[model samples]
Every structure is written in C-alpha cells, then in structure tokens.
Target chain A: MKIHEYQSKRVFAKYGVPIPNGKIAIAPKEAYDIAKDLGGKVIVKSQVLVGGRGKAGGVKLAKTPEEAEELAAKILGMKIKGLTVRKVLIDEASNIKSEIYLGITNDREKRMPVMMVSAEGGVEIEEVARVSPEKILKVHINPLLGLQGYQIRDIAASIELPRKNWKEFGVIAKGLWDAYNGSDATLAEINPLIITEEETMLAVDGKMLIDDSALFRHHDLAEMRDLDTEAESETIAREHDLAYIQLDGEIGCMVNGAGLAMTTMDIVTLFGGTAANFLDIGGGANAKKVGAAFRIILSDSNVKAVLINIFGGITRCDEVAKGILEAIEEVKPKVPMVVRLVGTNAEEGRALLADADMITAETLAEAARKVVAVAKEA
Target chain B: MSILINKDTRLLVQGITGNEGLFHSQQMAAYGTNIVAGVTPGKGGEWVMDGKVPVFDSVKIAAEATGANTSVIFVPARFAADAIFEAADAGIELIVCITEGVPVKDMMRVRAYIDQLDTRLLGPNCPGILTPGVAKVGIIPGDIAIPGNVGAVSRSGTLTYEVLYALKQKGMGASTCVGIGGDPVNGTNFIDVLAMFEDDPATDKIVMLGEIGGTDEEKAAEFIATKMTKPVAAFIAGQTAPPGKRMGHAGAIIQSGSGKASDKIKALEKAGVRVAKHPEELPDLFG
Candidate 1:
C-alpha cells in the first residue's frame, strides 16, 4: 500500500530521521495559514497516491502567503494521474547544499532486502540506475544480521561522500532501516537526502510501500488504508474474501482461481468482449460467498452480462452450483449469465444449474465465446 | 521415473491435525503415496487415522520414527517459516509448502537459512507435486493425471489442474507435475525443475506454464534455448492484465516496467519453444 508523502514523513520522523516540519491543509486558506506560520518560503505539495505529481504540476513553491493560497487553489481540485488532490502539505523549505539517494527494497535475485545509495539524486532513481549504473551502490543486508557496520562503511566510501558527512549518513541509513523494518515496509525511499547550508541533513522527500501480507501484524498501519482510491466493488470484494479488480468492459467475470480468473478475462478479450471486473471467489467457496460475488458483479453499471467459471479441484462443483442458485434467488440479475463448471463433481454441478435461466457451456473457450455473444446481443 | 516423488516416497504431513492436512493426507495415501507419519507439535503419541498414520510432536521424532523422506506443510502463514525451519533441521530431503500469504521478508530469511542445508523447498503458497499414478503430495487432483511421459511445471495451482485436464482430455498424461508457487522469491525455480525433467528419460515432452510477473519465465526461456533438446511447449497467462496490478497472486504483478506477457512469449518463441496462444491450444502443439 502506498502512503501519502506527509504520512511517510511522519513515520520517518519516529526513527530520528530529520524531516521538514509540515502541516496538512484541506483548503487554500488553511494552506496559506500554515505557510505563514512557518514564516519563510514553503513548498506546497499535493497529497495523492500516485507518482509523477510534480510533472503534472501538483507541486508548487510560494514566496509569500498569498502565493501559497493561489498555488493551493490551483492544486486542490486538480487531477494528477486520475487521482484528485484532496490535501496539500505545506512544509518549510530547506536550503540544499547537495543531493543524494537512499532506499531499501527486496532484491529478487539475492532474495534479501537490498539497500541502495547514489550520489546522483532528485531525479527518478530508476532513470539513474538505467543511464549511469555505476553511480549507485547497493548493499544486501541479511535479515539475520541487519544493517551491519561494514555495509554502511562500504556504501559510504563507494559513493565518495566527504569524510565529515559519513557519520550523519550512517545515522540516516540506520533510521531508514529501522523505519522499514519496524513498519513492514516493502520500500522505504528518500530520493533527495539533502545537506543544507546549516551543515545539517534532512530527508527532503520520502516514499514508503507497506506489505499487504504483513498487514495483520501491523494493526495501526492497516487503519491508514485509503478507501477513496479503491472502487466500491473492490472494497466489498475484500470484505467478502474475494479478489476483485475493476476493468472496462460489459461482461462481468467471476472465476475460481487467480490464474484461471486472469485466463478467463484474457479469453473474453480474445473473443472481443471486455470484462467489467475480475473477481476470484478463491479456493473454498460456499453459497454465501458466491451469492456475495454475484451481487458485487451486478453492482457494476457497465455490466451487460455475467460469466461464472469454476474449474473445481478440491472445491466441489455441486457446492458452487448451490451458490449460483442462491445468487440467482438473491440478485435476480437482469444481465445475461453464462456458467461453465468443470473438474470435481462438475457433472452434478452442471446438472444442478441446468434448470436455471442462465446459459451453460462445457469448455472454457466455448463459454467465453457464449458470454461475448450474449453480451453483444444484449 | 518421476522427477520429484515416486512409489517409494515416504511422506510426512506437517500440521496434520488441521483440516487441509487431514484431507490431503488421506488423498495422498489413497493415491498410493507412502504415508508414514504426521507432526502436530502437541499431538505427539496421538493418531490421525486408526494408527495407520502416526502423529509425532516434532519432525525430528517423526523422521526418526517413520523414516520419512519428504514432508508437506499445511500450516497457517504466521508459523510457516518456523515449520520450514523445523522440517529442515530434521533433515527432510524435500519440503513442499502449501500455505499462502507468508511474508516475503520471513521467506527471505528462511531461504537464506536453508541455503546452507541440503533441503529443497517448493512452495510457501503452492500446490504440491504429483507423481501421477504413483504418489500425490498436495492439492492437485490425482484423478486428472494418468501417469504417462510428459513433464509439467507451473506457477498457479488450479490453472495447473486445468492444463493437466486439457492434456488428459487429449489422452496425454504426465510423468510429474510441479507447482513452484507464485511468489517473487521461492526456494526452487523453473531451472531447478526444468533441468531435472530434461535429464529424466521417461519424459519425452515438457509443458511450462508462467504468468506475467518476474523474469523467471525469461530465464527459463534462456535455459530452454541453450540447454535442452526435449520438445518444449509453453503458455503464459495474464495477456490482458493491466500494468502495475497484481492479479490475486502476490508475485503476479507487472512492476517496474518488466514482466510483460508479450516479452516473455517473444523470448520463448525465439528460443524455439512452441508457444501456445491459449491453454486449450496447448494440446495441438505438444507433439
């Protein structure tokens, strides 16, 4: 999960990383007041869950309070990468003597949480890693023996940092490690760890990505889940223990496994139909969950037809058939539905659904084609 | 001969008192895998069946008592890594993990710790292996597999079943099928299983299934191109998947401008492997 810049900075502060003082404001006037209180030039950054905000003109610097208000007004309702800016963070501007980069993330090759440091900063780190790959230094920290002294010294010398700044850099590195480890963050990054003219270090910008699988252990961080960024069907699907992703199309798809769900959607597209959403009822499905899944699919405004595909392995097709019948009783959907049941007890399940108003197909490809044709006619 | 498990395979079921453990243990035993013992921590000196499958408190005692060679885990994700550590410490040769949602960090540490040992771990969130008509380990349906010569490896569970069903419909059967789980980091990779399949003389053809995440497929493609002479056909799912969205599997996302279906397909085709456009199209290309 992606957190707002302000929230990430708050988490960073707890680890003794120096971040600029900032206040979140929902209105232009509030932004101006916060900037005025800071008593110097402040930066107003739009708070959204997407990247490339600066390129989208969601970031602005103001010399005076009135200018701050003007910039905030322009940014408040502005859309960056399809997300509306709900709030603006007004932070005290720091004087930058130089810029550097630091972050920790999992390296698939090493299967360890690797820390990366680079002297070139304030740009897309990916771009830097692509162009001048030699400038970046990476250290893979063993989770057993985390953030070792040798790793810190190795990275500092590799990046050619001045001897005086080595101590401060080490502190920031340790702080970032603690925040990342303590918060269950998949990614903890500071693109521009700036050294100011006052000879002090500050984390100029911050980004953190939390691990969803580890959310149950971090109760407080899970509370920070942003509902506005998610579709209603997605939120409801999670509540019902289903995996749902909204897509553009008329045929609504509900399938059993994650891989089969994607293949179902792909085949639908191959047959020239678009899926309204991708919903996987998951492994062990009962009548209640299946009924809930049907309701969620029907809730989509674009859906003209629904396709239910189940290749039951451990899951009995007859049990899924009961769920479909229960869903038909509850939703009574006006949209056309094409049901395909295969695998364990699939014969009994297909027999059970035979009396329903929905259409049935034996093969997955044939079922996908049937749904597209029904949707096109509708 | 099968690549992973066969008729002589002695099996130990971890977390055997749980629902999944009990159901799959019976299934494996019924499918002809030698069910030796079970481990449930506190259920030592107990029995799962009418003493057909004995229960031990730890894997060490179970290994010593039953002389079990391989173990399958069905524990919850919170304690899965510890279960792996326990089974490894007991010197289980091969470990198959069926639990999903294990934290990547925990697996990272687990992978590192297991590196120094002699154990090969399969899935933290995977369906176990099936040496068809001989031994069935985890959740893959044993009925669909008829025990022929084709070898299979995949990243998804039910989809693996779907592909096997498709092959079975065409009167083709598999020597062995392995589900390596769909996480970013795993213990055994495509290369590990592919090399085994290549060396097995019973296997005449190979079916490799991949999704749109990670460079595992690309690496496998390279291996297939330069190393193997066996007839290989491949299928990659998630062709219509949008960028930066994970399609249910934790490792199924297309992140950082990599792991696209088109790129993987292109690499495989260039490697001279017959790539199936759809799952149903795989049977025609298998020959």
Candidate 2:
C-alpha cells in the first residue's frame, strides 16, 4: 500500500500542508520541460516506494534543465533495491536553513496514532530512535479527541522549534494528521520539513502507506496501486481475494490460513525445500476460490512441486480437495503435487483425492518431507 | 471454569441474517451454546433456525428482550465498527467480533470507546473463543476441541487449531482457547487473556501461539515470567519470512528491523517459557 513521494505530497497539499511546487515526469523530456518551468533548478527524485532513495543514488539535484534531463534519464534507468525507477518528481529546489522530522503512525503498544517530532530530519527516523532516542518527542493522539492545540504546542516546544514558525508548524502538523486519517494512511511522514531561506517551512519529501483494509472506502486511493511493483501472480491473487506473496524456491505453498501458510513455508525450509510463494486461500473458501488459488500457485515457473495444506475450521477440506482436483484437471500440471487435508471433513476430502495422481500426507511434517523429496526427484 | 464463556453465557448474534452469522450461530448452538436471540436491522419480526432464535431490529432490543449477556458479531468489515459500537451500547458484557478486514482506524476508535465501557472485546478478525465441551463462540470449530484443563491462546485461527489438534493427539485438551486475532490493533492481547487463565482454577498449563509483529508476545513473556505461576509454552511463526513483507496477517510483518521471530523467541526463552521450534513440537513443551 506504499505510494510514491509525489502521491504523498499530493495528499499533503490537499490537507493544507506546505509542499514545494512539483510535477511528475515519466520521461527525461518531461523532466526537462518541468525543470524549465521551475526556474531551471530542481531536484529530480526517483518515485519508487522505498526509503533511502538518496543513499541509493535515486535522488539527484539538477542545476540546469539539461542536467535535469540527464539526471532523470540516469535515475529512470537505475534500479533501487530491485525496483526500477519508472518516474521522477521534479520539485522546485529549496535553500534549506534547517531540517526537522514530523510524522504520524500507529503505536501498536499504545493502540493509538502517535505524532512524533524531532530536531533532526532528512534522515531515517528509526536511525534517530536507535542512536539518539531523546532527540525525538512523541505524543499519542486520542482518536476521539484528535490532535489538540496543546499537544501541538508540546511537540513544537519539546523539539525547540522557534516561536515565529509555531503557527505554521501547527498548521503543517494538523495537515499531516488529516492527510493520515483522511487517506486511511498507516503512515504519513514528511522528512526534512525544511526552513527555507525565506524562513517559511516547506515539506521537501513525503511518504505514505495506506491501510489495505481501508482501501474499500478510498476508491481513488485504491487506483493508486502500482502493478509495476508487484508480481503478476500477486496481482492475480489479490483480484481473487486471496493472499499471496511470491518467494524463491520450488514448492508452491497453498494453505488455508495466513499463519499456517507461513508456518508451512518455514516447515518446507526446515525440510530442505523452499517455498515458491505463500498463498492463503483464506477461511470458508469454496471450490471456486480454492481452484483460483491453486492456479495462481502454478502460475509461478519456479514451482517444481505444489503443496496444498488445509487445517479447515471455517474452510471445509472437501471443498479444498475438490478445488485442487478441478485445478489439476484444468491445468494438467506437470509438476509434482502433494496434498495434506485435516480437520472439518478431512476424511471425505482425503477420500476424494485418493484416486488423484498426487501424494497425500496426514500431517504437515510428512507433507513437507514427501513434497521436498518428490520435487528434488522431479 | 473458563475465562470468557460457559453454560451461563446467553448469546446474541449480530448480523445473524447473513451467511457467516447464521452458519456459525447454528454451529455454536449445536455445540450447546445457549441460543437466545439475534439482531439484524429491518428483520426484527422474523425468527431463524426453525423459529428457535428470534430476530430483533437492533442489539439494544435483542439484549433487552432476550436477556442475552454476550454477543458474537459477523458483520462485514464496512459495518463492523458500528456493529461493535452498537453491541457495546447495548450493555453486552462480552462482545466477540468475527468480522475480518475491519479498518484499523475504525478499530482505533472502537478500541478507545470500548476502553471506557466495562466490556471485554475479542477479535474483529479472530476465530473467537472456544471453551471446550461447554460453550463455543466465534468460528473456532468445536468438534476438534475436547474438554480438559489446559488453556490455549493464539494470535491465529487455523494455526491454533493445528496446535490444538497436535495437543489432542497426545490426549491433551483445553479449558479455553482464545484467538486474539492477527491485526496489529485488537480488542484483547496475550497479557489480558493470559492473566485470566492464570487466575482460572480449571486451567493448569498454558500454550500461546504468537507470530512476528508487535511486541505483544515479548510483553506477554515478561508477564509470564513476573506474574504467572503456571507453566507456559509458546510458538512464534514467520521465522523464515523476509523483512518488510506481511505474511498474510495484517500484523504479521517485520518492520523497522523489529518484530522478528528471533527477537520474540529469544525474549520468550529468556523468560523461561519453552518456545517451540516447530508447531508439531509444541505439545512436548506443555509440561
């Protein structure tokens, strides 16, 4: 659910947060045109949904329009942490006098949204937390009461922000909070909320991660889903309302629950086999959903074998077994397949799958061992 | 004998007209849960399950009319927050929400609002509670669970079922099994349920199934060491999962180099809780 810096800035601007004038460019020519309009001096930031873009050389300053094109071309061609920079944000460069960190995120321990402020900025907040914990001041916002003026003042004073900027700082803080709650964002951050040469604050960089469950409400935000950042199988799984995470390995894991799916992956690794992906068909899955999940698992070329594990509670094992059989009949998969069915009519499920050309195990450990051996042989 | 529900638990089903609600309601009643009434807006005059359970327009009316003390919610994610609020306002003592995919922000408010009320909330995405052979609430399949003195708690549903099946294989049953749900923000935590288990006379040993995410497990470890007298065994899933990738569960992610399985296991082991290396090995640590 991570959005690019430009998209976050868009959300921030909508909430009255001060942000530098910027435009998105998918090409070097667009970057050149944007730079020319922005007074020929701008920052070309790669719009990938990852942190440490500057350290990874995905961020660069262009002194001229031509240089902007050159830097954009270089950044667009580069990959940071394996994600290709498909676009760049050409922003009006700021003469930053000082930088500060301001952000809002869920504090799991407090079970509330916490606003954090620090004198140190333009760097990873986690690093500041680890190295100098005292530098960061935090305030937990009650969901009912929201970010109060007193809390804002407490943050500003604790961070030693000057009185002249307090009013603007409060505005930015409230806007950040709005952007966070309004967009259903799990995190809304502005690193390097810069004090410019003019002494006015401007957000130089932004990051936002929207909550996946809340995407149903924010249809506009849901369209911001970047398919380029996801595996094709993952997108397909999401479409089917199944949870799937691609991984390296040969055994394609299709399980009932999330925790059990992960545990199945671990057990696969423990048995000297690796899982190609983690696929949870979810609870109460009927034959059709199970079939869809099975096909998604087989979509991966890395898969040498398929392991279907179901500890049915809400999900009936017989339906899962029927889906697997239907999937095998349709796909006619060449890879070896192993099935483990237990709980909630598992006997009927196993009986239904007994005639299939697949290995069966009564337990997860047995299934992992058999699947790994069969995959190695296959 | 159980921490949450027993024979005295008169249950009301919110969203009872829906598929998941009606289905689990029937399953729960078949398991000997006291069937009282149901709540589905605009369907007040109807009776479901062969006219045995009457339907009401709202939780307030359902609670007032049926004298139901507890409620299990099966509404969709969009209406789940309001459902919890309605159930809470109705003065239901214990509310178990079975709806998955509730927005975290809604839960934030729900959690805050419920904190003010004298009520105990369990999973919005969880399988709820199963007090073996007495009363079954939520979606935890009752047939697999047997009546015994062992207490079990988990942040997962089917994984906990796997552990329970493994325990049952060794002739071990549970006094009560609670799934706290897998969301980062939930109504209850390991410590809340663990404290109840520690105080319950029917419970002997405790088994906790946790995953990588928040420090709930670590804090529970500290609580187990400092507060509890009963022996505790635990398992932390997602050990092999890569960092920053959510392993199906919304809360099951290793973020900011924290919530790693190694860290949780190290803390739990240091606190003298026998941490299982694998799910199958969990029952061996029950002693």
Candidate 3:
C-alpha cells in the first residue's frame, strides 16, 4: 500500500501543499527534459518503494540537464534496499533555511490518529524521538473534530517556529492532514518541510502509506500500487485472497489463518527447519483457493517441503484436503507435503487424504516436526 | 462463572443474513449460545437459521423485540462502525465485532462512542470471545476450546486456537478465551481482558498470547506485575518476523519502540509470567 515518493508528492500538491515542481522520468532523456524544464539544478531521485535510497547512492544533485541525465542514468538501474530503480524523479532544487518533521499516523495506545511535529527534520524521526525525546511534539486528533486550528498552532509553537512563519506552517500542516484524509492514508509524512530562501514552505520529500482495507473505496489510489516490490508468489496469492510472504527457508507453509501461519513458521524453525514462505489461506477458503495456495508454495524453487495446517472452524478441513489432492494432480510437485488437519470435518478430511502419498499428523507440533524431518531428508 | 457469556446470554447477530454472520450464528447456536434474534437492515420480518431465529431491520427493534443482551457484528468493514454504533445505541451491553479491515479512523470514533456507553466492545477485526461449554461468541473453533478453569486471551485468532489446543494437550482447558483483536484501535485490549479474567472466579490460571506491534502486551505485563496474582503463562508470536513488515495481521508489525517480541518476552519474564519460546513449549512452561 506504499506509493512512491513522487506519487505521494502529487497527492500532496492536490491538497495545496507546496512542492517543488517535479516530473517522474522513466529514461535518461525523459529525466533530462524534466531537468531542463525545471531550468536545470534538479535533484535526481531514484523512485523505489523501499527506503534508504539516498544512503544507497540512488539520489544525486545535478547542476545541469546533462548532469541530471547522467545521474538519472546511474540511478535508474541502481538497486536501493533490494528494489531496482525503474524511474527517477527530477525536481527543482531549492535552498533551505531550515527543516522540520511533520507526520500523521495512528497511535496504537491512544487508538487514534496523532500528528507528530519536530524541529529536527531531513533525518529519521525515530532517531529524534528516541534520543532527544523532547524535540518531537505529538497531538492526538479526534476523528470527528479533526486537526483543529489550535492544534496546528500548538504544533507550530512546539517546533519553535518564528511567529512570522506560523501562518504558513499552519497552511502546510493543514494541507498534509487534508491529503492524509483524502487518500485514506495510514501514514502521511513530510520529512523536511523546508523553508526556502524566499521564506516559503515546501514539502521537499513526502511519504504516504494507504490503508489496504480502504483501497476498495479509493479506486485511483488502488491503481497506484507498485507490484514490482512485491514477490511474484505474493501477488498471485493476493489475487487468490491468500496472505503470503516470501522468505528464505526450505519448508513452505500454508495455514488457515495469519496468526496460525506465523506460528507454523515458528514451530517449523523450532523443529530445525526454516520456513520458505509465510502463507495463509484465510477464512473459509474453499478447494480452489486452497489449491491456488498450494501451487503458489510449490512455485518457490527454494521450498524443499510443504506443510498444510488447518484448524477448520468455518473453514472445513475436508475442503482443504480436497484442494491439496486436486493441486497434487495438476502441479505434481516433487516436494514432500506434511498436513495436519483438525476441527470441523477433520476426520472426514483425514480420511480423504489417507490414501494419498502425503504425510499426515494429528497435532500441529507433530506436523511441524514431521515436515522439518521430511525437509531435512529431502 | 465465566468472564463474558453463559447459557443465560441472549445473543443478537448483526449482518445476520451475510455469509459470515449466518454461518457463525448457526455454529454458535448449535454450541448452546442463546441466539435470540438477528439484525439485518431491511431484512426485517424474515426468519433465518431454518426459521428458528427472528430477523429485525435494526439493532434497536431487534433488542426491543428479542430482549437480546449481547450482539456479534458480521457487517463489512465500511459499515462495521455504524453497526457497532447502532448496537450500542440500542443498549446492547456486550458487543463482539468480527468485521476485519474497519478503518482505524472509524474505530477511533467507535472507540470514543463506546467509551461513553456501558457497552464493552471486543473487536473490529477479532475472533470475538468464547466461554467454552456454556456460550461461544466470535469465531474461535468451539470444539478445540475445552471448557475448564484457565482464562485465555489473545490478539490473534488462529494462534489463540493453537494455544488452546496445546493447553488441551496438557489436560488444561479455558474458562474463557477472548480475542481482544489485532487491530491497533480495537475496542477491548489485553489489559482490559486480563482485568476481567483476574476478577472472574471461574478462572484459576491464565494464558496470554500476544504478538509484536503495539505495546499492549508490555502494558498487560505491567498490569500482571501489579494487579493479578493468578499464575500466568505467555507466548508471543512473530519472534522471527522481519522488522517493520506487517505479518499477516495488520497490527503485527515491529517498528520503533512499538511492541517488539523480544521486549515483550523479556518484560513478561521479568513480571513472573512464564514466556514460552515456542508455542508447543507452553505446556512445559506451565509445568
């Protein structure tokens, strides 16, 4: 649900947040044109979903359009935090008077959205909160009342902004809040809300994470989802409504729920085997979905064995067993499978899988042990 | 003497005609829950569950007509908060919301609204609560839940079932198993449920299953250190989870100073609660 920085800035600009004029370029020529259009002296930033792009040398300052093209050429194919840079953002570089941190995120303890502001900016906010502790200002916003004028003023004052700049700060903070609400964002951040040489504020960098659940309501935002950062198996699993995350291990796990899936992975590790991936078939998954999950697991070349653990409540165990049997017919994967089925229709499910060439167990612990053993042997 | 529901409980199912609502309603009723009525907007005057349960158009009419004391919501995420609001407005005291993906913004409002009332809401993305052998609310598998003296509370649903099953392996069962939910802004929390279980006479020992993400577990550990004298066994999942990635559950993430598994485990251990290294080790941890 994380959008690229350029995309985030676009959304921010719509809410009247001042942003340096920027353009996303897929090639060096496009980047050159963007820098030229911005009168050169642009920052060439590699566009990737993952963080640490700057530390990874994916960001460079260009004095001219040719330098911008050269930096874009270098950054476009560079990998930052394991994600290959497919696009580079060419933005007008501005002189900064000062930087400040501004963000809105959910507070788990307060069970509400809290706006966080800090004098320290252009760096990790966590570092400021952890070390300085007193630098950051937090304001819990009521969902009904929203970010009030007083709340904004309080944040501005806490950040030690000059009285002359308070009104402009108020506008930027309000714009960020508006963008956050408009996009159904779980986290809206503008690190280094910079004061330009002209004393005007501009969100030089932006980050936004949209809520996946609320994506059904926001069609335009949903289309912005970057699939390149996602694992191939994960994308397919999402299509099947299964929760899947790729990992480095020998055992592939498919469980009924997310919590149980993680536990399954942990138990497999405890039994001396690493889980290749985390996969949950979700609630009430039928034969087709379960089969899809099985195929997704088998698709991972590193997976030496597979484990299917089902504690069928509303999700019938027999249906899961049927799905495995059906998937085995199609995929015909050579990897060993260890299944532990319990709960509703479990006996019937076990009976259905009895004649199959798979290993079955009665308890999750036993299933984990057996799968790890089978994997080690394989 | 369970913490939440018993045989005398009159249950109302919101979004009753919906797939999850109808399915769980049938399962719960079969397990001896006194499901009095169902509330599905505009599906009033109809009968469901083989015409045994009455359906109402609104939570207000449903509560008035059926005298239901407890309600479970199966509405979709978008409408779930309003469903909870309607249920609270109708004066239903005990509410369990099974809907997942409710916006945190909506839940904040829902949380504020519920705090003003006498009602105790369980989850917007939880498996609800179950008092085994008496009344089963929520979506935890009833058969795996053996009724006994151990009070179990968890943030994850299937992991809750896994622990209960493990406890069953040790010849232990639960007085009540409450899934306080894994959402950042759930209505009820571990500390709230821990307090309830601490006071419930039917509970002797307690089992707490937590995951990384929020500091709720650390808070609960603090509460256990101060308030409860009950023998507590704890297990935290996502120990090996990658940092900052949502581990299936929305709330199961490890961020800066947010609930980290190692921190929670250490806190629980220091608080005299036995922390299980692996889920299967729970039984031995208790021993």
Candidate 4:
C-alpha cells in the first residue's frame, strides 16, 4: 500500500529523521493557515499516490500565504494522474545547498534488503540508473546481523559524502534501515535528502510503500490505508475474499488457479481474443463465489464473453458446475460463456452444464478457441 | 522426479488453527501429503484435524517432534514474515508461504533473511508449489494436478490452473507446477523456477505464465534466451489490460512501459520461448 508523501514524512519524522515542518490541508483556508504558520514561504504539494507530481504541476512554490492559498485552491480541485487533489501539503521552504537520494528496498537478485544512496538527488532514481549508473551506491544488509556501522560507512563513502558528514550520514542511514525494517516497508525512499544552507541534512520528500500482507501485524500502519484511491472492484473483491483484477479487454475470464488464468488469457489472445478481466475464484468456487465473480464481470460493460475454466482437485468439478449454474441464474449473464471442466467429476460437471446455452470445451485450448469464436461473433 | 517436492516430503503447517489454514491443511492431508504437525501460537498440545498431526506453538518444536523439513504457511500476511523466519531458523529446507497481502517490504526483509540461510522461500503472497501426484504445499486445488513431464510456472494461481488444464487436454501433465505469487517483489522469480525445471530430469517442456508488471519477465526472457535448453512455451496475460490499472494480481500492473504484456511477449519471443497469443494456442505450441 502506498501512502501520500506527507503521511510518509510523518512516519519518517517519528523515526527522528529531519524533515521540513509541514501540515496537511484539505482546503485553501487550511493552506493559508499552514503557510502563515510556516512564516509565509512554503511548498504546496498535491497529495496523490503516484509520482511525477512536479511535472504534472502538482507541486508549486509560494512566497506568501495568499499565494500558498491560491496554489492550494488551484491544486485542490485539479486532477493529476487520474486522482483529484483533495488535500495539499504545505511545508516550510528551505535554502538548498546540495541534494542527495537515499532509499531501502529488496534486491531480488541478491535476495536481500538493499540500501541505495546517491550524491545526486531530487530526480527519479530510474533516470540515475540509466544515465549515470555509477553515481548510485548499494549496500546489502545481512538479515541476521542487521545493518552495521561499517555497512553504513561503506555506503556513505561510495556516495562520496564528505568525511565531516560521514558520521551523520551513517546515523541517518541506520535510522532509515531501522524504520524500514520496523515498519515492514517494501520501499522507503527519501528523494532529495537536501543539505541546507545551514549544513544540516533534511528529508525534503518522503515516499513509502508498505506490504499489504504484513498489515495484519501492523494495525497502526494498516489504518492508514486510503480506500478512496483504490479501485472499487479491488476493494470489493477483498471484502469477498476473491482474487479479482479488472482489465480492459472485452472478454471476462473466470478461472480456478493463477497460472491457469494467465494461460487462459494467453490462449484467448492466441486465438485472436482480448480478455476483459482476470478473476480467480481461488479453490473455493462455491455458488456464492461464482455468483460474486459473475456479478463482478457483468459490472464491466466492456465484457462481451465470459470464460470459465476449472481444473478441479479439492474443488470438485461438480461443485464448480453447480456454482456456475447458480451464478447464471443469479447474474442472468448477458454475454456468451465458454466453460472448460477438467479433473475430478468433470463429466458430471459437464453434464450439469450441458443443458445451458454456454459453450463447453474439454480442454483449456478448446475453451479459449471457443471463447475467441464467441467474442468474434459478438 | 518433481522439482521441489514429492510424496515422500513431510509437511508442517504454520498457523494451522486459522480458518484458511485448517481448511487447506485438511485438503492437503487428504490428498496424501504427510502432514506431520501444525503450529499455532499458544494453541499447543491440541491436534488440529482429528488429532492426526500434533499442533505446536513454535516451528522448532514442530520440526523437532515431526522431523518435517518443508513447511507450508497459512499465517496472515502480518505474521507471515515471522512465520517464514521461524521456519527458516528451524532449519526447514523449503518454506512455502500461502499468505497474501504481506507488505512487499516485509517479504524483502524475510527474503533477505532466507537468503542468508540455506532455505528456499517460495512466497509471502503466493499459492505455494505443487508436485503432481505427490505433495501439494499450497492452497491450489490438488485434483487438477497429474504427475507428468510438463513443468509449469506462473505468477497467478487461477491462471496457472488454466494452463495445466490446457496441457492436460493435450495428454500432457505437470511434473511440478509452481505459483510464485503475484507481487512486485516476490521471493522466487520465473527464472528461478525455470532453472529448476531445466535441471529436473522429470521436466521435459516448460510452460511459463507471466503477467504485466515489473521487469521480471524481461529478466526471465533474457535468461531463457541464454541458459535454457528445454522447449519453453510462454504466455503473458493482461494484454488487454488498460494502462495504469492494476489487474487482479497487485503486481500485474502496466507501469511506464517497462512491464506490459506486449513488452513481455516481445522479450519472450525474442528469447526463443514459444509465445502463445491466446490460451487456446498453448496446446498447439507444445505439439
């Protein structure tokens, strides 16, 4: 789950990371008060979950409280990256001397948590990786031993930090790692960890992405989830305990397992078909789950056909067939459907489904072909 | 002849007292898995599932009493990392986490810890691994799997089943099929599984199921291009997925041109992996 920059900064500040004083505002008046409290010069930033807000005119500098209010007003109702700015963060402006970047994330290849630091900050790290790959420094932490003083020093030196600031940098790096580990964050990044004219380091921008699976242990962090920004279907699916993802194609896919769902779509496309959505009813393809899946698919107007593929193991094919029949009755599926039932009691499932208008295939390949044909006919 | 597991592998269930944990644990046991013990915090000394397997409070105790080397986790996402670490610390050789919604950061830390140890971690958000006609260590339906020569790997669970069903239609079955989970930073990648399948004598052909998101597919394609010797048939879902929208899989999002179905298909095709344009074409490619 991604938190807004302001929220991330709040968490960072709690960890003793220095950040410019900031207050979140939901209205222009609130922005004005925050700006006035910050002594007039402040940065107004839109509170969106995505990046490139600056390029999208979501971030603006204000010299006066009135300008801050004006900027806030302009941003409050504006849409950046499909999310309207409902709130703005007003932070005290600081004199910048130099900018640096620091972040912690899992390095898949190394199969370890890696801390990344660069002397150059205030820009996207991907650009840094592509343009000047040498500028970035990476340090992998030993999970058993945790981050040590030497590891931090090595990263600090690799980033070419001055000897005078090495100790402070080390301290900040260790703190960041601690926060990352403590919070169960997948990524904790401070883009543009600026050195102020006063020679003090401050995290000017903060971004954090927490792992959703870990939310069970961290109720405090889980409460920070912004449901409003998430997709309506995804939120509802979670409530139903169904694995659903809305896609853009015209064919709705309902399958029993993950790998099979991908292959079903792959076959659909191979047969000149476009899948509208990816729905996995999991191993529990009961009448209710199948009914819910049907409703979710019908919700998408783009859907022209529905593909139901089941490879029953613990999930009996006959039970899945009952679910499909019950769902068709409940949803009155307007679109065409291609059904494939394999494994346990498949023949019984096929016999039960045989009476319906739905097309049936013995194999997933045939099912995909049938669905593609149905979609083309539609 | 399977990649990671067979009928002889003894299984331990972590968080066995929970609804999903107990439900899938029973199903796995019924399917002939040697479920040695179950672990639930403070729920020790009670047998979950008709007193068949002893339930303990810790992985160490469960391992010591049962001599189980592999663990299947049904713990909630929050405690999943701790469960994985516990299993790893207990010297379990393979850990398959069936928990979903674990924060990517936690998995990274857990994965980092697992890397330091000799244990191989499957997922914090994945379905777990299934060796056909042998041991099923995840939440996937056991009936769909049949012991054969085709090796399947996928990021989506339901989708993985579709591929297996398609393969079964062509008189082919999986030696071992693994669902690596659909997360941005998963413990095992397609390349990792592909390498395993390549080395396994039982696996003849490999079917790779990928989705849009991240550069994992591109990396896998690069590896397949250079290292793989077996015939590989690949399929990428979410081709019709709207840009910027995340599919059912959280990691199945198309972002900034890096992880798109088209990009993945191109990369895989360039790597000499047989690309299936539609699910129906999969069987033809194998033939």
Per-candidate TM vs. native? 0.96, 0.97, 0.97, 0.85
DockQ score of each predicted structure, in the order shown: 0.70, 0.81, 0.66, 0.44
Runs with alpha carbons beyond 4 Å of true place in candidate 1: A27-33, A64-74
Model 4 chain B weakest lDDT span, ten residues long: B240-249
Model 1 accuracy (lDDT, Cα): 0.89
Instruction: Please write out the lDDT profile of model 2 over residues A245-343, one tens digit for every residue.
Output: 999899999998999998999899999999898888999999999999989988888899999999988899999989888998999999989999999
Ranking by lDDT: 2, 1, 3, 4
Task: Judging by DockQ, tell me the better candidate of 1 and 2.
Answer: 2
Which pairs of residues clash in candidate 2, taking residues 3 or more apart in a chain or in different chains?
none
> How well is each residue in B223-267 modelled by candidate 1, as lDDT tens digits?
998999898999898999999888988889898779999999999
- Cα error, candidate 1, residue A286 (Å): 1.4
| Better candidate number, 1 or 4, judged by DockQ | 1
- Per-model tally of clashing residue pairs: 0, 0, 0, 46
Residue pairs clashing, model 3: none
- In CAPRI terms, model 3 is classed as medium
Candidate 1 to truth, TM: 0.96
Off by more than 4 A, model 2: none
User: How well is each residue in B130-161 modelled by candidate 2, as lDDT tens digits?
Assistant: 99999999999997878888899999999999
